[model samples]
Target chain A: MNIISFLNILLPFGYAVAVYAYGKAFFADTPWAKSSKRWILLSVIGTHIVYLAARTTAFSHPPATTVYEVLTLLAFTTSAAYYVIESRTGNRETGYFILNIPFFFQLVSSLFIKDLLEVPEILRSNYFGFHVTAALAGYSAITLSAVYGFLYLMLYHEIKQTRFGAVYRKLPSLENLERMSVMAIWLAFFFLAAAMLAGVVWLPQAFSDFSYADPKLIGTVFIWLLYGAALAARRSTRWKGRKMMIVAISGFVISIFSLTAVNMLLSGFHRFN
Target chain B: MNLLCLSISHHTAPVEVRERLWLSPEEIVKTLPETLRLGCSEAVLFSTCNRTELYAVTDGRLPHESLIRELIKQKNAGSVVHESHFSVYRGPEAAGHLFRVASGIESMVLGDVQILMQVKEGYQLAVNAGTAGFFLHHLFPSAFHTGKRSRTETTIGTGAVSVGYAAVELAERIFENLRKKTALVIGAGETAKLTAKHLRGKNIGSLTITNRTQNRADQLARVLECSTIPFDRFRESLADADIVIASVRVDTHILTADDVARALEHRHTGALFLVDIGVPRNIDPAAGKLENVFLYDIDTLTAMVDENVHKRRAQIPAVERIVADELHSLELWHASLQSTPTIQALTAMMETIRKGEVEKNINRFGEKDRELVELVTKRIVNKILHTPIAYMRNGHDAGPTERLLSVNVIRRIFGLDHDNAKRDDDA
Candidate 1:
């Protein structure tokens, strides 16, 4: 009915159109279709920014209280990250695969738009805001790394099998995909470390009885260690190509589990409404 | 007016015959004017390693066979190719052939891109020599447009089909990005140098050249601005390289299965692509079975090239459709030119009759009335001629015989042929 509500309905539809356009461009290999996909994506991001700005203004805090709100925020961060990587690499062929994540999250967010809730006092700190934003960005980067890893393995198998089908012609070179995955992993490691630092600093102030037994805290530490090991292996060991790709992909799966299972199914101080 | 093309390509003539008929730049310069003198109003001579084509336009004054024979005789006094060996096409077929040639459909190597540049050069030479007239000036641009459309719209020019290019393409497939990958050339022979040049063009991270003769390797390295490693120490560099090109002239295998297995163990990561372009196969065929080692001998590379060539060949039907579309448009233009002389004579006759009648009626009226009468008579003549002029210009798409019959009837009724002949003589 209002601007925020209208944008809530429009954002998912916009993503749907962009996804369709990107898929068409990927298959048809038309420059015009690709350009249209880019413009549509930019406009969707614009609308998302407006919606988030309005929600924050109305609530007197960032939209980090509810599941739908976090989903919406994740959608925005993931799309932004994809835009940056796609621009840097000049590789748009992976858009259809990568954009699907944000599309699904945005759709879910829109479906639960009526469930917007007020933030609790402890969750409204600047430290909490920084932690949530950084964590989302890290998760988005890890997701991208996983996507590239999957593409690399697929192309590698296709080449090894000598199928030489659409995948062989359309996918980026295996080396390029590997490089992109490594770059994404590095970005993910940096942001995840920042989020952990922010969370550790905020713990003493926000909780009267902060403990190491919290599921969210334990999951976050586990993911950090796993990715750290992956990065260390990449730098030190001769574990590259398929081994490195598998590491990145598994790291993404663990991050997703921590984000969903540890936050909802398990009791933690980081739980949302 | 008529357009004609006389061509002898690798398909129609043997190499000896093509060599005899080939035209050098100096020969084209010397013989182009002679070709024009033989009643060719315009001409473009295109000569490449695989083909030599002469596309010409004439005013229907000289026979096409005589013009072709005289030109061939000038190039080779004792011509081995009979006139029949030179395929001839007239009218729209001639335009279609030029389009096909420009678009690389007629290339010995399917979708070879070099011929497009050669076509542009030939057209430029014809223009500079003052042999290109209205028809050729229009034809060349349309042909170029068709060539560009076919390439962009189809997958005819997508992959690498030559041996040197195939090596580079395979490297890209293995590593995805060559900018961060190193390449090692095994010998200082022509194939090795060519493969190194192709790799360099891809902006590889580094290039190392090694040969049995250190002096030759250094010479080549200096030219390529790359480093030269000792021939014996080349195996040390192999562990660091992403691509190894073995083109040495040794009868024995330069790289054995055990050697590559050792290198693979040392280089624990990434795939090592070995291209054995040498005849006796420098890399052992068994080495290809080793883990993370990809060895492609000459036969394997040739098979890849053949596969790519077949892919390009599959695109010929699409290119031919483009050629046919262009030819149709060109035919409409050419047909428009056919009715020009008749239209000009008809307009000239009408103007003369209007002026003569105006002079005879001048004395029957006062000065003001005579001026008004002249204007009215001029308008009447133009009004009467408008339908016929419009019909002539717009009727170009009609059947040729029917259009010719209509033109003949108009000329008979208006007596335009005599006027046109007389006007030509006066001019």
Candidate 2:
């Protein structure tokens, strides 16, 4: 197989091993697993970077040209976002929870992905690249917030219920999880806002069929507003611990629905399937 | 040569007796040099609240009892603890003892996080006193390696193993930074004071203590150097607290579900961590059911402490295996030290015999013939010694104990053991 195909196969395989390594380190605390997990994750990230650059250069258009290609890029950006978080916090305990998303995303993307030899000239626009990158970053941040929210809730339940089992033993503290989730939500808001700004400024000028009332655009804006109000709301009426976590999770659900249903069912210039 | 560890610990002696044998830093400095005069080559003493272990490397000139007697005499602990309270481990067993102590398997509290540091301090004391030498130089690092491995490889050192730290742990579980959080301590009882101390150890931002009697609350606040709220105003202050430790000695619940729910309504805090460690329990059970309110009574904290202790206990076998592996590695390295001295002694004996015969026969020959006889005799001894030296160099597969035995065999075979040679001479 060519380098791209080999990387396509290696992406899921590499991530699977990293997941296992991180899981073993978290549960069993094996010496080898604890030592090797970070290096394995680093190698996988390196390979993923190479694969993305190669795929763009090989196809004459960026991977964001199609939904399937964007899935592959999403997988990369999500894992990349997690890498940044893990590196900064010096905590590798939550990697298994985070890496599983990209693992599955890459698996699906690799299976259905096609080589697009021809594309519209606008697909090569630097504005489109910025818009897609910002959108992917926004989605990745949303995924991080959702995962941290889920972990926060699990640990919260474990503490409140007095189980004090694996969820309590392994996961980060509720306060830390809350901070991470809020930070991610704030990050997602800015990125999605930027993506929307790019779309508004360029879509009306570039495409003949571009409409201001596209379903995808409306859905993204709705997600952006939901998180925006939650993060920026008043202190006395503000959502903090449990209420804030639930809002973050719900926002992620809405984003997923927008990504899947709105793109598949609705017709618009945003749908590039 | 032998490395010996003489231990008087909580396991073998009561705390009253162990305390009598405990050595202060000044006492250890004064007593450490006396070990060398007592016929030991090297010495290190681990004297903590629970254990007082004296590690010495002796040349088998002094018996273990005399060393034990000297230690007991040094402490003036004759009437306090009998000699039987001391547990003696020699050779590899002594190395194993040091490893277990460093790894916290022999600690009174299952995973003694501070014991490793204590071990380091003991080793450092020996180093400063110029007591530890060749053998200890290798053995203590192995013990340290064992300690590090046990902590990293197993979950022994993780979690709050002490029941008293449950409140602090729960606070940590809820909040990211304790420096930004405020804790309201209800009541001035012992449990409340202890919980306050625990929070203080974590450096809580603000501490507001309340008691039924305002004077007692002021006294405790002064001691802890925090503020005090009136007993009646404590409920109002609850809305501002991120953590409420209700350890009041009350017959009825001080915090009810309604009170907590009302506080949470006005609170923009992370979560309400209620640690009720009072007799007759201070917080209502229904308070735990409220959203964003986590109430842990004494029973729950005790249960978590018990489980954490069990988790640490379960890691003992793994830790022991690490100890054994490191001890074996050390012994093998020590066994390698054995061959060099043995080879030198053997060669010296052979050379002595060769020189004596050549001197007696030199007059019977010419000068040139005498030189020829000397060269022939030296070559013959060299050929005889080659096999044993080669065997010693190539014997890496020998296990720890077996390697030591093999070294003994070589000594006995070459008559390098002084005791055997003296015995043979007397016969």
Candidate 3:
């Protein structure tokens, strides 16, 4: 393989190593391991950025039209999102679980990259690029929220059952996990809203005979309403902590199912080549 | 040089005996010089609630037991202490014990963070008193480094082990920020006071202390620099309080389900955490079942502390590895002290012989030629001495005994005696 493809293949492994380091730091309490994990993650992001740039130049459009390219973009956005959150919160303990999403996506994308095909002319617009980027960012944020929710429930059950195992000791406090989940949900809601707005504004101009009944559009709108309702419920004090965590986790699961069904099986304008 | 440690800790002595051996700051100042006068080459007196250890470096003339007895007698004045109350460790074991103590492995609560600071303070006090000499100057910093490594490299100091600390940790878990929360301590008991102290240390927004007796509440409030409410009126403040620590001792429950329900009604929008550390369960258990009300009693807090303690205990092997690594370096430094003088004497003797032989051959050469010949001969002599000197300094990774035997063989081969070795040390 050429240099860019070689680095692309290695990126997933680098993320795997970073995730492993985070786990070691969490369980072994090795301070240097956390720092090493961070640096390795940053290097992987740098290499991924270079690879994306190379692909964009080679394809004469943004690298968001093919299934593998979209998957790669999602992985990069999720990891970047996680890195930002980790830097802000100084909470590296949850990184092992949160990073697995990006690592898996990148691994699958790299393995199936040879199957990528040419995109239709209509799918190569800047508006479509913005729409895909915004959607990927929102999905990554939802994934992060789901991971935080998972950690919250795990710690909550551990505390309630008095297990006090490795999860109990290593994870952040329940309140912290709840707060982080809420924060990620808020980001997800904002980005999904922006993605929907972009798609709504661009569809009529690009297609000239736009239909609102597209499955991807309906799915995106449904996911948006779900998170929006979850955020609204959070404003009322009763639907907080555990209730909000469930909402975030369920929203993520529905979004993933919707995205997969729309991309793989449904006949839609948003389908990748 | 003999390193010795005489310690009386919670493990070795009861509170009564430990109290007798406890040295206050003033007592340390007064008695530390007396310890030096009693023929200790160097001394550091470390005293905390859990342990009191006096680490000394001394000449072999003074008996370790008698010296410790004299130092204790001088410090305690008329108090009688049995010899069995104190445990003595000498040489490498003494260094190891000090390292373990600094690393908090030997604490009553495993992996306490306070002992390291206490160790540092003890070393500083010894330095201030002009009692910490070369050995302690090396040992104390090494112990501190080991303590830092143990804390960072292992999970030893990761969690809260005390009930009061666990209560604070729970409060943190329930609330997003302690700075925005108010704590209501429901008794003037010690546990309540400690709980309040821990809350204050976390910089909680405000604190309210309540007791059946108004004066006791006021006393505690004054100490904690917070306001006090009449015992009957504490439930009114509970609506504003984010955390309620009920440590009161009473027959009936101080906070019932109805009371908590009323408080929750007033709270309206946030979580209310209740920690009942009292023996009789100050907060009703049913109150914990209420929405947005998190109640934890002493058993729960104790379980958390026990879990944390277990986690820290599991890190003992990792910490021990760090201690072993530090001890190895320290022993190497100590061994070099043994081998240094012999190495110096051997180098001096070789230089002397080389210079004497060079002078006998120098008369045949001119002045400039003599200078060149001297430089060449000096370089040759140094190159010849380099291998043996390096071997003497660092070849043996064995204990001091074997290293001492090796040094003795080198001394005999070089015809170096104690006087010549002393001269080399002075040089």
Candidate 4:
């Protein structure tokens, strides 16, 4: 079979394995807890590598030519971020669901978008790789962190209710989740800032007139500020647990809207349309 | 033996009762043996600020119910206890409960993480007191193993954890390198003291402790190897401090906008960070609105701590799986205990039958020639018992019953288990 057909099959199979493995890791009575998750992680990475190779081979160029390629790259970033957060936080359960869902979309997107599509002239730049990759990486990490934060908040509520039995038995210590989310947000902040910085630096040379407040630009900045606020709130404000989780989730939502919705709809300088 | 656990934790009982019931290591050593003498084979006393639990594995013949009641009555003489005063789980269930407890599954704060060490300490205390017998020795190590397994294998022990650690994390965010930073603790209360200790552990270049009682501040300072400042000089110290943790009990906002603005004038442009851990609030919320000023109140910190608390909660299933996996091996060992003696008795009976058969058979061969035959018979018996005995000891079979039953087919060949005719029906 052709590479597209292979990827179409392999990618979805990987996603299925990831979901099943993650579920087994979360609920099984055996050593599948670690092994299953590790297998899923390996499968995702393997599939992504294959997908990248196929895309690169098909395009006869690097895989950053169109929105589809960027989406594919973003899928890889999300998986990478999820694994990093999972290892760092040691939180395999909550993060599993968050990590698996992104691949589902990426896999679906890939199946249909495999026929080489032409990119808008504005999209064909070396800076495109830096911008899309950084933003998505940041976005993925933020989403993972947001999930961790939500778990933290739920556990905190359970503790407050004075009903610490079954659910309490399953969660990580609150302090660990809080620390992990903070770390995730901080890492995302660094990447997002880098992405914005790259865009702004390259804007003047690339385009005749680059608006300072392009929708994507403005949205990206808003996410940066929101994350900055989260960091500040956590720092001087001592923002933790539920509050931190809410902020993380909110920040991820903003990122999604900025990166996807705004780019698809509004006639902004950065829109794919 | 009666195995019981009498506990007043952050659950059924409040902090006051828990603290009152708390016992030190010295106290555990003194009390454990006495508690065991009251009718237990093993006694492990776990007492911490958040919980006080007494776990005992005793003779099954002991009056487990009244014995625990009397112990609690003696311990909590003046205290009010209803019918639901303490929870009592028995047998394998008790073992499972304690395993979970040691694994931090039964913590009041849901993955508090310190209970495992405390459980270990309690086990050690029982061992030291000579109250932990073979059963307890086997049981406690399993519990410790389970705790370790749970912590390592599961996400329950992972993520944004620790309130004090989180506080330090927030502080680090303000000043990336704490080694060059100065930290000011504004109270001598538990939270403040803990925050100070966490900061100290982080090696924040200079630590200045300030409390209403200068002596308390000095005491912490000595322990932390830092200096102390007067409570009145808190505002004055704020400017020099790169991180300020306000843990004092003040009804009003101690650090006002003007106070922070003044501190900012003397502070490095991006350095100063403020944390208010006081209940009625310490630093004014409005101070955060000021340029280059970052202020966090107690409510905010608590919120952060709570959020992380939730995330860790989500990881509980993974941690529990770790605990359960380790507990599986332990259960196998425990179940083996039930059938071990039966296997031993069966093996002994079979060996006796084999020697008897050899003696009977050798009489026809004459004395000198029979010696070699006796040696051969003994060697045969040893060979026959080796695999089954080894497997049973490793907790494979219900004992040698299955192997011995199979050997009935070769009864004439090995001449084993003649007495098994009597015990077979009973077995």
**Prediction 2 TM-score vs. true:** 0.90
Query: What digit string (tens of lDDT, one per residue) describes model 2 on residues A155-262?
Result: 988887788778887787887888778878888999999999999998888989998799889999999999988987725474788888898899999998998898
DockQ of each: 0.59, 0.74, 0.35, 0.03
Better of 2 and 4 by lDDT: 2
Expressed as tens digits, the lDDT of each residue in A104-170 for candidate 1 is: 9999999986534466776667788788888888888999999999998888777655556777788
Worst 10 residues of 1 chain B by lDDT: B396-405
Tens-digit lDDT track of model 3 for B58-154? 8866777776677568656346667787899989899999999989999988998999999999889889999999999999999999999998778
Could you tell me how far off, in angstroms, the CA of residue A257 lies in candidate 3 after the best superposition? 3.8
What CAPRI grade goes to candidate 1?
medium
lDDT of each residue in A67-122, candidate 3, tens digit only? 88888999999998888787777776788888888889899998887523476787
Task: List candidate 4 segments past 4 Å from native.
Answer: A12-43, A54-105, A114-273, B1-115, B122-133, B146-182, B189-191, B194-206, B212-216, B230-233, B236-243, B247-252, B261-281, B288-335, B350-427
Best by DockQ: 2
DockQ of 1: 0.59
* DockQ order of candidates, top first: 2, 1, 3, 4
Evaluated at residue B137, the lDDT of candidate 1 is 96
Q: lDDT tens string, model 4, A181-229?
A: 7778988998899888888888767777688878888988898998898
Stretches of candidate 2 off by over 4 Å are A31-39, A234-237, B34-39, B59-79, B213-227, B351-383, B418-427
lDDT of 2: 0.87
Give the per-residue lDDT digits (tens) of candidate 1, residues B1-427.
3888889899898988888888887777677788888888889887888888888988766787887787678777464867777888887778888999988988888887888999998888888888888989999999999889889888888788878888898778778678888889999998788889989989989999999999999999998999989999998777888899999888899888888888877785588888999988898889877645667788767877888888998999999998888877776666566678889878888998988988887898987798799889989999999998888888856765566677778888897887678788999
Question: What order do you get sorting by lDDT, best first?
Answer: 2, 3, 1, 4
Candidate lDDT values, in order = 0.84, 0.87, 0.84, 0.70
